[model samples]
Target chain A: MNEDAVAGEKSLKGIAVYPGIVIGKAQLVDRSKVKIQYQYLVNTEHLNGEVGRFEEALRVVEKEIASLKNGMAEKVNDLSFILDSHLMILKDNMLRDSTIRAIRDEKINAEWALKKSLEKIRKVFEQIDDEYISNRISDVENVTERILRTLSGKAQQSLSEIDRRVIVVAHDLSPADTTELNLGRVMGFITDVGGRTSHTAIVAQALEIPAIVGLESATDVVADGDLLIVDGSTGVVVVNPDDRAIIYYQEKKLQLEDYRSSIARQSHLPALTPDGQRITVMANIEFLEEVTAVRNYGGEGIGLYRTEFLYLRSKGFPEEEDLFEDYREIAELMAPESVNIRTLDIGGDKFVSELEITKEMNPALGLRAIRFCLKRPEIFKTQLRAILRASVHGHIRLIFPMISGLQELLDAKDILEQVKMDLDRDHIPYNEKMEVGIMVEIPSAVVMAGVLARHVDFFSIGTNDLIQYSLAIDRVNEHVAHMYQPFDPALIRMIGRVVTAGRSEGIRVTLCGEMAGDPLCVPILLGLGLDALSMNARSMPLIKKIVRAMPMSQARDDLKEIMGLYTVHEVQQYLFERIGGMFPELREKGYL
Target chain B: MEMVRRLKIRNSLGLHARAAAKIVELADRYESELFLKKDGRQVDGSNILSILTLACPKGTDMEVRIIGEDSEQFMTELDALFQGKFGENK
Candidate 1:
């Protein structure tokens, strides 16, 4: 009940998309409760006046959209394209004429007529087969809703009007709704429906705001102006927390800020052990624009560029030229530092409808990554050719993802060789000496790392998948997610074996996974003799700070003891005790 | 003075909102009464909703009719848009 939550009785749990801690008053923007009443015009003489009223409402909505566009012009580059479409919809004579016609013929109020016009447009949009175009219906609905609100004389309630900083609790925020939020006055946001990859979540991350999404009853339980604690790191939302809980989180917030500032100060410094051993720290990026973040956080190079985004974001297969241009730009930007381009790792969570792959019983273990690429060589070759062509521009390295065995690795490389031969025949210039590598994410890959290492230049351990496959747990499934342990003895042993295997083959081994970014796991990974650590750009500075503070000799010694531990709990306990003392910041946050 | 030209939508996305907006923007610049006819259903070229109501996808053939003093010049410019695929490659 809202009463119990407001009385400081309970906390809600959700998915943590962006990490931070914030305490603020809750501002409920319940758009779903806004009901529009359909009213009919009683008099015939009011027809022209009704049409004029509708036009006036349209103008007001247009001005609102224009102001919104101007407000976000500097913050977001891609917003203009969406706003431009909204402007077109507002200026649409078809919408205007039809609404006026309906008002005259049906003797209805402007709101009802506008709704009718929107319905006609919605019907047309529904008939369209294209997914991208059909999605535009939301834009139309948003614009029309604004107009209807204006027609009904509802005063605009701007998020900017809040006198103090607040945490927005909403059913869900559209991209436009999220943009309208004044980031300065808003500390964070909690939504009832959305995932990490949603537009609102991405915008929240860009704004550096704490956000907890997919909390089904966030709006219902959290009352307006109730003091709320949003722990985005742990995905906990304490509605009207008790004094003690507030004080604790407040101290944690300060500690987090202090920790962040300390790491940021050490960002430009090299990631090195106290014993003066340099450990290369690179970034794993999904979008090309994130390179700026990578550079800002002091990543030496791109360790893994997830190329599946090219397919996921596209309506159909991305043309080779477009792919080439994007790759070339990133390569040119990071000139001397290598860009390890991972070939298309589609299927599973990242599916392209155009691929028309049948639904599998278990997508994670099904035909995906290297298997998907091998099955669709035409698509794979297009990406390979683009990467090969871009290789000449900078230090480019090709990495194959989800290689379960030596045969899959060889088959993928064979396709690459075929692509290279085609490029040679076509007189396309590329870096012939571009390094080829495989992601050691599969248990089989770890077992065959020595043989696989001999066939490649490097090994990047994708711990997220490796732990999932090794422990036989789907990380995304909440029921089994608790079993997905990174500190499991089996996972640690497998990773250690892969590191040794790469060393035996005289090749560098890197960890480009969630575990690599985790500060508590960094000492153990460094001790395991990992040549490099790659992670999200945001985590680079903190990891680097931890790595710089730790002595390689001590970590190596601690690793032997850690490996000897029999269970995940023992290994975790050992790491907590050891890493906690070394990094007091981690200790204060209880991360260790 | 009426000028008519038959053209095919070349852009893969057909005449979606953006493309329809382009046609309307260009059509509004002239004094001619521009009408777009597809499969016998004609709508005002200057109205995006009417243009969209035609539901013209890629490869759909349509007739553009302009009736006014500047009909010839208007037809020429409209033809250019069709040929250029409204500046959208995909």
Candidate 2:
């Protein structure tokens, strides 16, 4: 529950990332960036002392990286090489000599002089034309950012150490914060930033926790240990709910628990529509630990197995053995069913954006996903080799992310072929017939799906990016989030084109997006005749129940009527009216 | 000894961080001044960032100039490292 709303109840609103109701004491963690941005000038007498302070900070950072290296190497030896490179950067002469020169000659404090030197080096890095080599600018940025944090003497709060079950409220969780946070102790979370598909939001959905994000001021409003009621379904946070409101939520909580238990009992059943059409429902997961949850939630297999954690966990392009171990575990765990591994889907900006390195207006539009991988084929090859090596352990397929063009698709395949040839020469065993696919997210990819369909084994539609890119509205921005509509007539037609293209090529077309998990969007997906629907594991049972309840002919008929609708509101209203009439029992069961 | 040798950067990633680290580490062991000249721009061999700035891709022909007593020994080690592609087989 929330802030020091001690005397009276208050209401706050945000975009709901996950659907659930939870009442807990608020844990107001201060994840504020250190404000070491103050400026100072050293006197001529103190300039040497200022220079000495900078040297000491470098030593501190060096020691920190070394310790991280030693500790991480114990688990994965390949990680140490990445740190060795960082060490070399830390001790680079231009970085050290210039900072010293700035302190002595310019008569400024060490922090400011170091910042100046970093700016100079960044300028040099910016001039480089090679995008991959230019991206090394972030390595410089990270080393500088680490040193700045060291100088400020305010280390980040290790979120994994939180012991008590509570609602975590933060300004914005960095990629580090999102990955390392202790989910076992978290009851719910509310943040001042992030959209429905943001890193933190995806984590919350995968773990099925109650979370609300983009509150704009939750950090300013919520106080520690205050009684707060978070309704993730309604995107409402009540600070210190009154007795009457408590009674209402208490009853609703019981109903949720009841519905959850009932769903778990039937989640294992195959989803067959009334017209005898079977749909494969899989789960999108980031961590290997989430494999168990997919099995429990009746997921047929893993779809969109995001490989972001594999690289981030080890702090670099992870070792092939480590990647192989993880992929093999998931493949073996989900034996008969296939696991679709989506390769690294991040960009250079993810590491630098939060650190304030460069002013990239839109990280989404910048170099990311397939573009990033293709630029640095060394990193891409590592993951491809791991996936290929792990294919023999169990049923595994490969899916590349953000394929905006046919060339990117072909280039990725060429790398895959090269890796396979390397493995063949080395006598390493792998599934030679492993299915390869591409995520149809970018608008250009959808328009050219017909041409691209000739090459790939399957297509997994990533609707989150499709909606944002096509609509030209940033979902994270609350101002334009209202425009992030799933039922827009344009999207329906685009999806129809993709489905027809896939059908003509005789390849399975599935969806692995947030839309697949949504109850209201289920009929629309069914109408498109998608072969498989993958989503958050928790959403599977309800989706299956809906699939069993409605006939495909009915959904197709409903789709035909909605396809002619001009606006998002009209389409949503029509679906709501149709659902209310067709599935009256779902409403009674609290499923509608 | 004073000598100059031309060598090709053979690694898939070019003169990247780890490769540069090997060159820097080798240069530090001998009392020699080693410099790599690529495309008319030369950088100190003992400095990692300088080597990175050179940005020599996999097939770039780099000119190495050395001066001092241990120049011969330094050349032998640098040649071995470059030929082995800094042991990066990925």
Candidate 3:
């Protein structure tokens, strides 16, 4: 069995959107090959019948959509808007009337007429200048494709039906198609194209399904009913696995479930050390809808609410009221628990089409974050006005990102003050004492944290950016990503300086980067005296469990020993030994 | 009675999806035969696809024509919509 597995096993790598392991039979769904046969009617008398056929197809697709909506009604929230829009497209006169006209005038079959109508509409959409607006063409295509599939009698092959559990392999799954999947029978999904932030990925995470996207050729390579193993955490897909490999994955799958159940049991408990020192665990979110998940995972508050998504998702600048509504909902939902809103961290990796920011040789160091806001104060002020208006709804704290020095911090604060004055003059109620802070990500910010701390209420060390900037490594560049070490002696010492500065000035300091949620680094961060650890919502439970079992005093002693280590390897090994010795149960459970 | 109203699209995104949805929602309320004209191209007021095809970007001048018993009332409501910038402020 081992030799057979070694001889026949093939593995593929992709982006891990959700973490789980599953072994199941492969079910390939190739919607891209759904070809529409263009046929012409032989007689003029057939026009009425052809139109009727098209109408019937539309009705059938509408019913399918309604059932899809019904299937997700209680389990999913906020999906009705998208499903309703698809229903509207089904009833659209432009689509219906144009197809009817084509069938009557061109003497074409129902499928051909509908395709022609969709093609005409898609051509017009292509001419639109805005990328966000033009992207609507895909929605039109998705809807028309569904109707076309119904006309071709291929609609029933969608993931809505499966007598046995299978791993779905497809080119891509639309939001609507993803909702139609039978949760009980669908073990996981592997797609040819998608990233961690795509809508399909988000839905997969919400559904708690194991998914690996960007496989590039998973649909073409895997055949139906072939044995398959999907490890979403490692983004590895093994096809044609033998008995030994299947057994290995089955054991891993069980271990993952056990770990999840153990964490779920402790989710409601407070994150406290054995000595009774409390550590606040919060979630960093990019969308308001994630607040529910944060609450479910026992996040005390939203430590970092990224506001740039509102701008990037819109065709142009998001209106103040639209921004206000989003912030208000998040604030109202998490009242008494603080929601730290980071204002406009755009540039470098995130670019808005409307902004027309010229491509730079080094976007990471160029006009981004506070620099972009300072250059365009009106854009900055508009966001400030909306955030200020939302401040009165709940505990909302404003934090400026990428503040390289004191001037940028003061300038941003100055615009904020002006927005507040305008709101006050308009007789708008806002929290006058809303606390403001700056992210100490850049090395200069770390050097000048003492001065910056005096001006702001708190400091959040964005370790993701700090490590990149301090080490001069573009973490995204694969050639140098190996050099992006979080355990570097210089980086740890810099973090120590910032934490010390925040402590001496009597201001709370938080860590809200990828490093904060990492269980291996939690002790190091706690020993550095971080007031809060903000991470993804899913990571909070395990991190909290680890924090609750260890004493802060022991962690501090380990931190001292770690700081004395000369090399990154030495620090990591020493910390692992100490943490493993302290929690043998965790080590046995493969958590340490 | 027949009525016509000329207005400029003040919303930054022009007649995009949400804006078109709002227009269709409003137009569906009246029994009048409403049409929008921009650059000599006419589109049915209640049809989102036709409205989107017009590609009426921000600041584009458009004319709305209505012919029915309730044309005057429909014209008044549409005039308010235009004046309000379709409930979107720059």
Candidate 4:
């Protein structure tokens, strides 16, 4: 690195994605040396000494990797995927063979051969034009740095601690950087080469660090020992910020802190309307680790617990014992509190690693949720066994998704029975009286609800999918997504029918999708006879506040007044004015 | 003595770059010296191209039994890693 080259580089500015201020030394992630090493490796040698060199080089690389891993462990939330890469390279054959050949024929040293071999593979990735596949540059640089340092016999220096807050800027951070980072001491993160969806961003978000990514030369602009401020919410970073700017932002920071404490204080209080109506606030969890959020958020119980997370990091089926362990943990944590577990809703758009349910032209309409479960009775049975076994530990309800009709329901129920009988035969304990529920997403379920509701214990309307299917639009397809309206008359009518039918059968009716969490639809759903509202944990407190502000009678009346509206905009505006007109403070605060 | 876990490239594309990288990644995570074997011959599991060279096609089940401290977790993760099509493009 030349001093002139560093001086010639210009600064680039962009929005900061997280907030805080700190000044720290710089750690550059350089890979140019690896490129040079690659260019020099073209020869080969076949000798015991050459083989020994390769072995020695590998040991050095391994040690560097170990030291890096130790350095990054506490700072990162998840380093499994990153470490997994190193493991693969250490055992890689093509790289070893190519390097050995380069050593034997090209007459290159082990370090150069390794670099050259990695470059060739990296070039292949670059040609693919897929970021997901091509983003192995970080991994390559990490491995090269380790191997190079090892061969040079240089002891790795200990990373500096963040005694005061600081901003970390990098080309891209390895999992080691994440693990080794002292997040409490660091203020935020800004990276030049990582995507928002990349592992680096995921960790930064988990640590609640303000992070901005995809900047071209962020690391070059923010100098070592220069003061830097990160605004996480707006994704803004300021270099050597003025005092006035700092004072203004300091107030903003204080306000945010106040709001956070207010939200926390309200968690323990029941969400009710000024007029006495109560709203059920529940938590949605993807993993058992998130159960803590439910308690922290003061949620009533688990509304939706996605079971797919258990299968996410594994290749085959999760061990029945492991699955049982996780389920039991949740059940025990929420004992006497109901937790609704949805059956594995894989296939369609979601490709399960172990089971690739048929790829279809229309995944949302194809074999998924209930349909997939019915097709693979055994897979369904295993989950059902685990859920049923878990039920004995607490109050648990099993919900089937993507239900279109009676037969899918019947066949699924049949499998559930077989699982129960098997458990009984094996003398395994389970909650025999566990409630069964169905997500009314398919139009057929809505149309024949009166007949279908007779057999179910509860019906939860999954409005996100229901709206997409009802409009014949793909919610994920950006072009047509806007046309998928939850407030469409047809969707409203379907929801009305399902809720009415459920009440007639003496079955509880709930809305568990995104629609359940929306403040605008609260009164409309209550007017239509929805008995419960289940939504994500984050939105629970605010929705509860909305529910508590309105009287049931007033809500029903307001719904009746707005029901005759023909369009979503008309309905939205009418409700906004009616609700906001009464609560000016809430409306002014953007609570609507 | 080190043991090897040999899994053929069962994905549609012959151990495309990402899949190959994934295999290498998984092998390095544990204490084992993992290798991919083909027809009684073994190649380093950590090398991206050597694993791809085995050219194990879709539906081809390659054995990946390991011997190391984290062997069980390694083998289990390897199974998923191979099956994911290495975050395939398209």
Number of the predicted model whose DockQ against the real structure is largest = 3
Which TM-score values does chain B get in all models? 0.97, 0.96, 0.94, 0.73
Ranking of models by DockQ: 3, 2, 1, 4
How much lDDT does candidate 1 score? 0.80
For candidate 3, give the lDDT of residue B42. Answer: 90
| lDDT of every predicted structure (CA atoms) | 0.80, 0.81, 0.81, 0.66
Recovery fraction of native interface contacts for candidate 4: 0.49
DockQ for model 3 equals 0.49
Summing lDDT over every window of 10 consecutive residues in candidate 4 chain A, give the lowest-scoring window.
A2-11
Among these predictions, the greatest TM-score belongs to 1
Candidate 2: stretches off by over 4 Å: A1-9, A33-163, A348-359, A580-592, B1-90
Candidate ranking under lDDT, highest first, comes to 2, 3, 1, 4
Per-residue lDDT over B1-90 for candidate 3, one digit per residue giving the tens place of the 0 to 100 score: 899889788877677766776778778898998899998989888877677778777888999999999999889888888778787765
Q: What C-alpha lDDT, on a 0 to 100 scale, does residue A304 get in candidate 2? A: 76
Model 4 residue A579 CA deviation in Å: 4.3
**Candidate 2: tens digits of C-alpha lDDT, residues B1-90:** 898999988876777766887898888788999999999999888887788888888899999999999899889888999899887663
Q: Write the per-residue lDDT of candidate 4 for residues A1-592, one digit (tens) a residue.
A: 3212221223244433233333343333434422233333332433446657677777766765666567664423235445556755664554666777777677767777777777887776566443433555556666666666555443232134345455677776654455445556656677775443344554564354657665666766765545555555444556665565556556656665565457567776787767666666787666576677677767788877878655644434566777777788898898778898888877644554345444478867777777777877777888898898888898899999888899888888889999999999999999888999898888888998888888789988878678877878764443454466666767777898888899889998888776775667777876776777877565576567667767789878977777688887788788778767766644533345
Residue B11's C-alpha lDDT in candidate 1? 88
Give the CAPRI class of candidate 4. Answer: acceptable
Give me the runs in candidate 4 sitting further than 4 Å from their true place.
Answer: A1-85, A91-93, A96-250, A348-350, A356-362, A472-489, A582-592, B1-52, B55-90
lDDT of 3 by residue, A187-260 (tens): 89898876554445555665568888878788778876677888887778888877777777777778888878
